[model samples]
Target: MDPAPSLPPSYEEPAYRVFLDSLDYLPPTDVERIKSAFAFSAKAHAHQKRMSGEPYITHPLAVAGAVVEWRMDADAVCAALLHDTMEDTGATKQELAEKFGKPVAELVDGLSKLDKMEFASYQEAQAENFRKMLMAMARDLRVVLIKLADRQHNVQTMSAMRVDKRVRIARETLEIYAPIALRLGLNKLYRDLQDTSFRLIHPHRAEVLSKALKAARGNRAELLGRIQDGICDKLAHAGLKADVFGREKSLYSIFRKMKDKHLSFSQVLDIYGFRVVVDNVPTCYLALGALHALYKPVPGKFKDYIAIPKANGYQSLHTTLIGPYGTPVEVQIRTREMHNVAQEGVAAHWLYKDDGESSADLQIKTHKWLQSLLEMQSSDSAEFFENVKIDLFPDEVYVFTPKGKILAMPSGATAVDFAYAVHTDVGNHCSAARINHELAPLRTELKNGDLVEIVTSPKATPNPVWLSYVKTGRARSKIRHFLRTTQNEESARLGERLLRQELLSLGVVPISIPGEAWDALVKAGGQQSLEEVYTDIGLGKRLPSVVARRLLAREDIQADKAQHMTLAIHGNEGMAIQLARCCQPIPGDPIIGSIRKGSGMVIHTHDCPSIRKSRSSEPQKWIDVEWEPEDGKLFDLRIRIEVKNTRGVLAQVSGAIAEAGSNIEHVSMDADPERLFTLLRFTIQVANRTHLAAVMRGLRHIPEVTRITRERGGEA
Candidate 1:
């Protein structure tokens, strides 16, 4: 699809030459391929101009330069050069494939958007584009590398666009692209993108931070120099050969620290740090020792990444030291190889030719993460975006498995996340977990270095509740997927049973309807088939009684056999219908049913306040419901009791409940320390309302019980 006509170019050659110069690491043939792709893209947009009034090709050329700076593959450079072609210039993917070959064509395809695919809203369009780009990146990590480069360049030149458009793009870059860079361990790109986006999205805040940082750097110049010189001399005296460089934290990093910690600019420490890159692992430790000896090391502030690498494979010895004039200075010690990994992250294998560890190892890790994205891909665009973003945060904690393997998970991840990280099967069948050899709840937050053991049972399965506390997107998505499948299966069964029961009670007595009549019934209800109708009925999307009435009215049934009857509910209906916890209605209560969307019948006492509130707005949702006699089952009844604040009051209350033949399933206390009385709430299992009344009467007989009341309508 061709876009609006582009403006004429004013000047471009010297910048293009500079871009070509950055490709010194590329092979001569690869360089020629990049140039060829550039020429093709240039020809495609020969008459087009960017918002900045330059030949639109300059944007792609600039993006290619960023990709080259990232040291991406030759195909990435070619893709970066032609990233806009298919999206803007009416250049078809097939034509690009013929010219640039399949790999480059595929990279370009991944980088391109479905601009011609009409969407109902801008958000829908954006979500679709975001999902498309991420899936492409999942297949080829280079796709995101090139896309981030493209975004970096765009954000840099966004001032030329309309103000609202510029702000929108900047916000997108900050929220999406910057996090991806951090997740990939591209510190340089991450920082650059963050700072650029920060400047555009929050210019005033960025300006304030920039000024504060400049002043701080100047004020500490002398002290920082002394610290750097002392570290260098100490390392040399220790017979360690290393390069000590002063590293100033980026403005964006400082801004984040201040904002997240709620600290002022001056209160943010570690704004200026030092990095010591040595020749080998032994030298790295020796350098750390020397630095620590020179400056008093801060206790509990040391992290030995060399022993336990981060999830992104970054390794270093990080320690904070009290520098000259009481200023805190952070020092990072790593081998030259480690330093490269620290800076470039996963891209280090390609950016700098490594000797021992090949790019294959890094690629494996990348592919694992990308595979998770593919696994969690959803048809709902917004859901897909949200789930993928959950994986982009870089903060992590390292925990151990039952065996000695260390698994890195996101911060705040629970034991359930660890189970899933181990294996999908283990997670699916996880029943209980032991953290550090002690039984712990599945929602327990995992700590670093804790050894976790997950116990599984053959009958165990994923719980929907796990989604509430799971930190990892993989676990949340998997649990949700399992629940959806389970719900569908259960709903289908329940729907069938409900439909049959309704028909039998209505005296229709037909096993099946004629195929044509069923088809007409389904089509009239805007459904695909009779099965969906049943499933919907079971899931409460449609009332089974309504569906039966619709079908029975059309089909010939003996009028004499038709009986006006209300179906008897036995309270063992599974998910087809549930007794509302708000009222906890048993067989003897005057109960009414509400057909909730996607959650079949909910039985509430007729006097329930919640039912009364919903009844006005949705009178049709109310259905006549009754209970069958002799269907012995337990139901929960909540009662609140006020007792004197004296010793053994709880024991007495428990004894009274046991004597009444009602079990106290749960108890909560709201007691005032200085008051004469305390309130206790008990959720007790009883056979019926009469049984509950007996329990309440038993509690009142106790002298300590000042006030006793049964709770209903969502109280207590």
Candidate 2:
């Protein structure tokens, strides 16, 4: 806890001196540790130079300075100074850990790129590195904080790099880093990253917008000053002391507004606004009322974020007012502490010395987001990266749970997303939802302040279709993970069945294979285990016949004698066994199975034209498959009917089908008003061919019907 000593006159590196000066808030011991880390990093990178022709040590120093500006702890600052040692130099994590603490070494390790590993593509390598860093961030938040500082410094000095490389880095900053900054509620850093990246990517457009913004600033200076004065006077008259200032939109935000809204530069009003900083929450509302009385408030343009904070813990009262000369003026009101949190985000944990409720709330919310990243750590690198990107959306809606807890969600988020946000189990078992006490579909989009109640059933599971509409990465990743796991299990079961049948046909007993034989087979196939080999087989990447031969070859068994065995279908096998849509097959039909890659077995009627063509081209893929006896299972079949054009004909046809114990899944009609006859196609569910015949007979009894025929091969 001793105070840091003064720096000697011989130490004259400006960046290092400035960085050390920022450490005044830290104790002498902590500052000494940071200095030692800097010395170590400088020696490690002494021979290296950056693309900007500066000593590589300067880069780490600049990154450490950024971290210091965020008021991070001594360990984080130390880690920032040594972030690149493991990646560029021969310095080992063990050495760093022995020098510094384990935490600092771990942070540095997380920030280092995976340059020693080989990958199929550059994008793949980048994704792996990102995944590694994100996983580490989940364990310790300082990892990402330091990494962001590093990325910011790298992006700021990219002018010396190739144009293509600069563009790539700029785009990554805009798409990933900028959004991540905003997600962490680091508004200042977000704005700086966004504006810098925008300028680099679209230099010409940024220049034009910069010139336009400058011109508009000159024209609006008088009006902005007048509005600021008016707001300050109104708050003062109301006996509330507040800090009011004119705020200008960033260059990137202005350009985004124009591009997204398709508005001309002149049409984008509220380019300049006012932010009022108050003493407390109640005073913020009072100041808001005073400002509204000063100017006419715009309808439907006010958002009370204080009541329901944003996903990133940003809270404020935002409103738009009609100023003098019919121009719109935007205003934001919050407490002084809130302003600090808004600007520094999670960094306010250290920026503000107090561990009050505000800081605690920010910590809880930030940890919740970090926990979600950990939940997705099992996903592939590319998919994990995509999910994180989807989660970094800034626009959000606030919804309430049944118990009055407010949950902030991405804009356009549906009930499924809300369910996942509530809990992964709720999302997995969510069957329906009740929005505002009214029962609604799971896909219904949620709105602000709407009360949402998720209806979950033990028997329910995530639908693949939910992936199309879900707005949050958590929901999407959970659904995908569930589906993937389920698919693998189902495929393994099917592969077992296929392999058993193949073994029986080759006069071999399935249970006779020893564990050693299976292990040998797995090794020969270059697989991790027997389950993966089965999954590959069931996924149709490997043929069952080929796998059976390989297993028998390991056992030193001959396949000269063969006994044919037919694979049985129960009509209820999940994902692995699908019925052909072109020729819908029921329980009693003559069926053939085709193994489609990544699709498992597709059942088709023996006489199906598509099957006929496929059998000729891929006879080896066709298997002897027969339907098991019907056990009250229904299958879909298509039928075409020619009927007289008349009113009530549709109702009569539907009634007859229902009377015949058949349910119509879907129906379509094609009738020309000038024609006497109409064509109706119905997809009906029934047990077997006999049940289908009963339905057709019942339909024939209608006098309006001219012909009845079954449809196959997608033909009428």
Candidate 3:
């Protein structure tokens, strides 16, 4: 494409001509629309000047030229030209729509930021604006394409801005835009954004690194040429025609490698590489073989991406070889299609302008990532931003399902993360996992190529602990949502029970809907409805007595109003109610409930010292409670076994617990060198008092076990 002949050789016309020439790939009608848009933007911004003292119109023109270089659609080109008109000038979206078209107007609207809006803080404003742009990008990807072009131009001319402003914009580009570009497979844009941002953010470090890189390039210039020539000659001799070219590693990328690996400039090898572009996939392997024949391939440095494409649809064969003078020169071999996708990412689809397999594949992959943004929108801003950061990483590990289907997950992802990646339901009900058909913990870090089979049970549900190890946003969000919902339900149930019991003791039977009483209660408590009051009580935010008193005061007092409400007693009550860890209470034990703020009720053994102490302090918070027997419910118990200081005493005690059909969840030993006995604490899961008694009886038969007692409040 050449510059448009319509423009004369003038300072202002060249930028528009560059954009015009790039539009040669478009139809004449589309080209004229873009030109019209350029004219409109130029007129709208005629009085405006950039901080660099150039006409403000030049920035959009430059962005349009870059978009055209990416081979974006004609609508995208028109949008690039007029993106800022609505934000900066008096032009309206409807007017742009009337002049250009609806698509162009929509694209322009998406590219426009929220500079006119108010926010709590600069970070808040930035996050909100970024979120708006992402929402627009999710609707139409062209929004991001133009946004990237705009950022690239801004970063290019960033020196015109103040140092603080320059650094802020540069950091945004690096932390946000560059990662998005990389994720979209826009390698060219990604590298440019990264390099520009690095230059602006750390000028001195960039200069030092650039100098070191220039010196390294000069020293290896001959070696690089020889390696490229050698690979080309080998392919030619092998009867495989290919296009071979050398590419220098970007400065930011080199710096990242050094910083991440803690290396000095001298230790960063493979500063530049050669790429072999062929016609098809088979030739990619042939080129690889030819390269291996030309030089000794480095061990463990060969990667065949052709077999399994990257998450971004990058397919290639990478090999690091020992070149002349023992220099390690990395080489990548791929077909022409792979090269296009690798360089342009999703944009290559539009650049190629094909609805063929490559474009469709890239489009589908890109849409999945965009859809994730929508999924993340419901999260709080801080969490959403953190999740976006997690998505920026390009490294991935390919694991397989039990049926041999492959799944690409981030590095260090756990089995629970994979379970969620498979499906949210699977993750929610996942009890255990089988890695390579061997039982593995849910938190087991998955390795590449490992076959994972999730073992789910209908009774199983998500554990709060899973949040600590999960790597993906989806898993974390789902776990939190489930736990939050469960907590609310549990808290509400416990609160209702406590309120009914307290009202019964006060000789007041609370009704769900007592008309004037309910209204007065709602007004007194400042709640919308009775459910709100109950939920608040459940959350420990408000006490049941206050709410009950408010309701009781609304109605005339009557004698013999007492009534009992049955509360369900299901063991292991999720996260709503908990057995006091200090007491280690079992169902068989005489237990009382204590209302804990924000944590609902905590059940403690009546004899527990912790409960005795609490009775003296917050006696009003304690409530009488009784156990309801339910079959097959396990209770946690801590028992201390005092055994003679004999070698096999520990083994005998463990065997007795097992014989009594109790599972020892945990065990700890304390040896008293001055005494003849060892105090061993064992945490066991049992059904009830009968089961515990059987275990105690079995242990008593063992002569080495001199004394045994259940532990409560850190004491036996």
Q: Which candidate is the best by lDDT?
A: 2
- Stretches of candidate 2 off by over 4 Å are 1-11, 512-516, 554-561
- Each prediction's TM-score versus the true structure: 0.91, 0.95, 0.89
Can you write out model 2's per-residue Cα lDDT over 1-716, one digit (the tens) per residue? 22233444533577677777889999988988887887788778878899889878889999999999988898999899899899888899999898888898899998889999999987788889988888788788888888888888888888899989999999999999999889888999999999999888998999999999899889888988888888888888999999999887898988898999998888885555889999899998898889889999999999998987887779899999998888888899999888988998888887886736786788788888878866765547888888888988999888999998888889999999999999999999999999999999999999888999999999899999999999888899999989989888888888989999999898879898888888888999999988998888888999998889888784455555768789998977888888999999998899999888998888999989766776998899999899888577899999999999988999999999999998899999898688798999999999998888888889889999999988888875
Clash pairs (backbone) in predicted model 2: none
Relative to the true structure, candidate 1 has a C-alpha RMSD (angstroms) of 4.0
Residues 482-577 of candidate 3: C-alpha lDDT, one tens digit per residue? 887789887777778777876875666666537897788778878787776777787778877667766667334443463534344555776767
lDDT of 3 at 634: 85
Please list all clashing residue pairs in model 1, or write none if there are none: 6-48, 6-49, 7-49
- Candidate 2's displacement at residue 290, Å, is 1.4
Q: Which scores better on lDDT, 1 or 2? A: 2
**Count of residue pairs whose backbone atoms collide, per candidate:** 3, 0, 1
Off by over 4 Å in 3: 1-13, 43-55, 89-91, 114-127, 160-165, 270-272, 376-379, 512-532, 553-571, 588-594, 606-624, 673-677, 689-694, 706-710, 713-716
Evaluated against the true structure, the overall lDDT of model 1 is 0.81
In TM-score terms, candidate 2 sits at 0.95
Tens-place lDDT digits, model 1, residues 1-716 = 12223323533478877887888998987877777787787888889988778888888888888778768888888888899888888888899787778898899989888788989888778888988887887778888888888888888888878778878988888788888787777888888998998898888998988888888888878878888889889988989888988987787888888889998877884455889889999888888777888989999999988888776667789998887777888888988887777677667767887544734565677777777777876667877777777877788888988779988889999989999888888999999999999999999999888999999999888877788789888888788777776766767776776677778767656566666766777899998767778778767888776787787664455546656445467776666678888888877898887767787778888888767778888886776678887645788878889999999899999999999988789999998778789999888888887887888888889999999887887664
